[model samples]
Target: MAFDEGLLGQEAILSLFEAARWAASASNGQPWRFVWSQRDGSELHKRLVACLKPGNDVWAPKAPLLILTVTRTTRERDGAPHPWALYDLGLAMGNLTAQASSMGLLVHNMAGFFPEKAKELFSLPADHEPVTMVAVGRLGDPEGLPEKLRARELAERTRKPLSEIFLGQSP
Candidate 1:
């Protein structure tokens, strides 16, 4: 998704996180965590943008906010593997995106980042795994993107039909 350069206030950012915090998790483990940086031309912002792959860097730097999602790999109480940690993080991100949309903001989640770099940059513990990086801001003009990306942006959005996604036998 494309984003404008407009800055989001602290309150708005916190509200988005608040929405994410309410997402469902396995056994209420609540293993999802986020580290975010807003674009103000600061060193932190630049570092966050630098974590993105070159393809993402081409566009994501223009976003006003960047968030890194991390999930706890094990349960806190028992120290067992949390198989659903990634799924729970997905739920939280869904909440975040919905909240952002409600506030007339756009969110683009990208996997095109160096997770190892993120770990180094954020000083994440051994039990935490970086999952995704989200770019957030207001919608921007597609014309600002490269021709290929602009074309892709204008392309029709599609999703797999139930027939393709479901496992039940066809009638």
Candidate 2:
């Protein structure tokens, strides 16, 4: 869906992040971290926007909020390779988006970003890796989107069947 330039209240945003914090994680690692910026046009926001790729930057930058999703690549306790960190982060993001939906907000996740640049720009720890970004805001009229995007947003949404996605036989 397209998004309006609607701003979200601090309490509402906090609720979404808090919901993500409670998601189940491998070894209770809770390895997800978010570097978020609002549409107030701060320098930080501009810097974050530069991290997005061309096609994504076209629309994502207009959302009310942008979040750089990072995951700990190694276990925090002993620095061992945390193979499940990315999966754990996905769980957290699931919680966040669910909470946003419940509050009548929208979230759009994208992989089109330069993670290396994001790391360098933010001075994040080497163990923490950026993988995805999310745009959050209130739903808006499809007509508000750029022509190409409007068509894509209004197109019928489709997904692979569970039978096609899963490995084993159907239950």
What lDDT does model 2 reach? 0.91
TM-scores of all candidate predictions against the true structure = 0.96, 0.95
Q: Which residue pairs come into collision in candidate 2? A: none
After superposition on all C-alphas, the RMSD of every candidate to the true structure, in Å, is 1.2, 1.2
Q: How big is the positional error of residue 79 in model 1, measured in Å on the Cα after superposition? A: 1.6
- The residue-level lDDT of candidate 1 at 32 comes to 98
Of candidate 1, the 10-residue stretch with the lowest lDDT total is 162-171
Error of 1 at 54 (Å): 0.9
lDDT of 1 by residue, 70-103 (tens): 9999999899999999999999999999999999
Once superposed on the true structure, which residue ranges of model 2 sit more than 4 Å away at CA? none
